[model samples]
Target: MEPDKLPLVQCSLALLAERLTPRDRVSIVGYAGNAGLVLEPTYDKEKVVAALARLEADGSTAGGQGIELAYRFAERNRMEGGINRIFLATDGDFNVGVTDIRALIGMVERERDTGITLTTLGFGSGNYNDAMMEQIADHANGNHAYIDNPREAQKVLEEELSSTLFTSPRT
Candidate 1:
């Protein structure tokens, strides 16, 4: 959650954005405290950063709300032009809210039908929640990665843009 680490995440998102054919929608579900804020698909960097910072300061940091928000956002996006994905960037801490891992995974699995993949980016180390991150991404038909540094983030954004952009068909 350092200032320096943000650019890496943002850069990754930006890289992913470029590959989007102007028709693709990228929604962000960011959680900080007990609240989950859904950001509409947009390529505006400053607005995205401000939204993320506000959520970071709000403080509940619940992953379940974040997931819920993403699912709902995807549903809404689907009505428009179908959803590309819901990207969750966090340290993987799911406290102060729904803490049941199995239940959360179940919810994500159900949402996968909406055609929105879930990609999780784990940041920081001391309080990271690897199990939860892996479960959500896996169940949602997406991949999870740990971003320990800015460089790694850029590499992921620049390199894995395709895999991250394409959603798996519901099985």
Candidate 2:
């Protein structure tokens, strides 16, 4: 993650927290060299927002582990007919482990049958792997977006919250 793009990530997460209702269950995950469960699946907006605030753009990216952890959280607490999704905000760096694009895509693709969508919010420009993010999301039956500013974050997470959160974006 780019240090300069940190605010945009905060704004995006804040927007998401603001838009989530009591019915929605959210799990927050952060990854650098590995993955950490920032929050369990919960309806408490404060917990979710606080977890997002704890994320800092400092360290090597372990995107594969992060996605895997998010999937586990989603799968464990998955609702029968509810929208179970993993919302990844990153600079698209996968340096620490399982960096192979094919392997990462396959990891996510295999989880499609579980019905946990994987939406990626791309941040920053340098070293950003847009194609990989797009392909991962596409294969996981979800959407991909590049959020360059707070406004774009709002447009992606706030304005389109309903559609993006519950249903796949229309191609």
Candidate 3:
């Protein structure tokens, strides 16, 4: 990933952070060669911002591990009536670990019953697989957005934050 895009990601995160309240919780999970929790679920926006700042986009995408770890965190910290989502910001490449699309869909489908939705943010060019991102979101009963620049990031992560985060109860 280009170093310049880091600022755009940080900017988007800041915008999202601005909208957060004490009732909101954030967890940051990053994957490169492997997946790890950057920040545990917490109400502190500053902590979330700090975690995002420390991120560097390098190495192959280990999306499967990342998704599994993210789901684990979401399940553990689930809010009874509040939003439970995993915002997967990626270039849509899963080069390492469970790269098969069918496998990915199955994994996401299994988590659907947990009431944890996925929102895929497509970043980067050339390697950005919009189809894969859309499929992942669809399987998880969520949404997908293609964001190549700061403006698009703002539109999805800031201007439409509420719509992306809030969902009507599944009846």
Candidate 4:
């Protein structure tokens, strides 16, 4: 049997879209094998939730595609003069395909130099890969946290909204 689609991840993404600035660019990175999965365009909460419902656990290669999509978005937005981040919402279990933790971390690290940060919101429990999620966030110069409930998602989004949106701290 396959795992269920995480509602918390969907809610968090929805909340994020609500808080994004007009200058901010939003992109989603979800599993490729999930046929009905579609990342809604920025600010489209209903579409995002609809897309999340169709998501399914595929393979580790899906994670790689997520990373690639994020990097490509960052590259394109390099000249936009605003915050750039890849908000990855996953269970963190990289299996059924190419599962090189190091390679994933390296890719995130390389992109960080270009001012692209990675924030991971982990979902589920049993199959969660805490180390990979945390390491990717750290190497990408960003942050990671698990959201098992809706309230936690709100806290993370409301409290860290500034940290997540603003690229630099005001001195």
- State the C-alpha lDDT per candidate: 0.69, 0.82, 0.83, 0.67
lDDT of 1 by residue, 1-171 (tens): 465345455655555555655555566766667545456766565555555544443435777877787777677667445545777877547886788889888988888776677888887666678888988888998888888776777677777754566656546
- Cα lDDT of model 4 by residue, 1-171, tens digit: 223235566667777667655555565556644312255345455555566566555544367666776678667756456666777788657663446888887787677777777777787787788888888888887788888777888888888766566544211
- Better TM-score candidate (1, 2): 2
| lDDT at position 34, candidate 4 | 31
The model with the greatest lDDT is: 3
Any idea what lDDT model 3 has? 0.83
TM-score of each predicted structure versus truth: 0.79, 0.91, 0.91, 0.79
Q: How many residue pairs clash in each candidate?
A: 5, 0, 0, 0
Write one digit per residue (lDDT tens) for candidate 2, span 1-171.
454466678768877888677888888888876889878878887887788778776668989999999999999989898888888888757888888989998998889888888998898878888998998889888888999888788788877766667654433
Lowest summed lDDT across 10 adjacent residues in model 3 is found at 162-171
Q: Which residue pairs collide in model 2, if any?
A: none
RMSD of 2: 2.3
